[model samples]
Target: MTTALIADDEAHLAQYLKQQLAACWPELEIVSVARNGIEAAEQISAWQPELAFLDIQMPGLNGLEVAQGIEGATRVVFVTAYDDYAVEAFDAAALDYLLKPLKTERLLACVARLKAALGRPPAVDESRLAETLQRLLAPPVQGLARLRFIRAASGDMTHQVAVDEVLFFHADDKYTVVRTAQGEHLIRTTITDLAAQLDPEQFWQVHRSTLINLAHLVGTRRDEMSRLFVRIKGHAQELPVSRAYVHLFKAM
Candidate 1:
């Protein structure tokens, strides 16, 4: 029996795919279900399943990153809400794409192709998906990211720090404290507003009062309660990595 892993952010969507897979390939064994790309990567790496159903977009690592992370281990059937550069890359790489919400017929067809591909000595798509992932991991562009200008309360503080340099942004009662390589400064912004403005790829909403730059990420390890903590540069304090955001490091 073929073992499979399914990864998607939405719990309902993952459930839907589970049902579809059960119908399409009753004999198949689903080894694991991951709620996000990062979790998927960890499970895929650990289980090394023969087949994986991966969603193309997610909060932290994204589907492409997870796929590239599990390079030669499994055959991928990409499930994406919409097509983009990643889809084009997948097509060029000769891998299959399954648009979401996954249709039963399309899923069955994909399974059939996977079975065929498995029969033939797996023809791995030796494409540049790794390079694509590297690009995705890079710090996002200026306009695409949310930035705060920091000024000194005293004289001659003309330089404004880029948001990328920030270690963390804390929300006070009426102001947001922006901490960076240089120092901390007060900015008039709300965590909610900043979250909306920030690029999801660059800055992760770790908590209600905190936003962290993935580029500055140093390490993540489970605490006493199986909760995760993230360490960042420019700050000695380790921040909480909520379960909601835990998937961010699964691939890393």
Candidate 2:
């Protein structure tokens, strides 16, 4: 039996995908399920499964990073919630991808393709994967409208804040705090959800719980402990930069 692995942060979604895979390809054996990209990378290294179903966005390393870390050939089927632009990129590189809220028919087609490919020799083109990843990670080109304003709540009042005026976002319990020069406002959205909606070039996730507006970034400083902290213009608060994301400010 062919062994496979599923990596997704959402437990429900991962289980659903596994169930669908079982229905479509009973011969495939799922060896493990990973909760995050870091765990997925570890499992991939240890088991080296023949196939991996990777979620595009995760806490640690993203799916593309995990795929690049694999030592041997492993067929990857990316799962993402992105729209047609990303789908077109996947198609251009001839890579397999499954859009979110996956349909049975679409999955069946993917399974059929996987089965056919499994019968043949491994044909993973590194160059193509690299090109695809580059396109996926890069910020969107000009002319595309980005998030201009955010609606946040303060007490019983709802306020619309311009994106440019925002300083940063912090994950607090079940809600996210939108900080600005004026004050802090609460939003029910999670940082992960906000990351998808914000402009990549304008906002950068410096830590798991923090996403900073790049336009307001003053500079980075290293504490006595050698930990990196980011300073934003007009904000006395300094944000910690997690090791996983420290590379983002290397050139700055």
Per-model clash counts, in order, read 0, 0
Number of the top candidate by TM-score?
2
Q: How does model 1 score by TM-score?
A: 0.52
lDDT of each: 0.70, 0.78
Off by over 4 Å in 1: 92-94, 132-252
TM-score of every prediction relative to native: 0.52, 0.53
Q: How far off is residue 13 in model 2, in Å?
A: 0.4
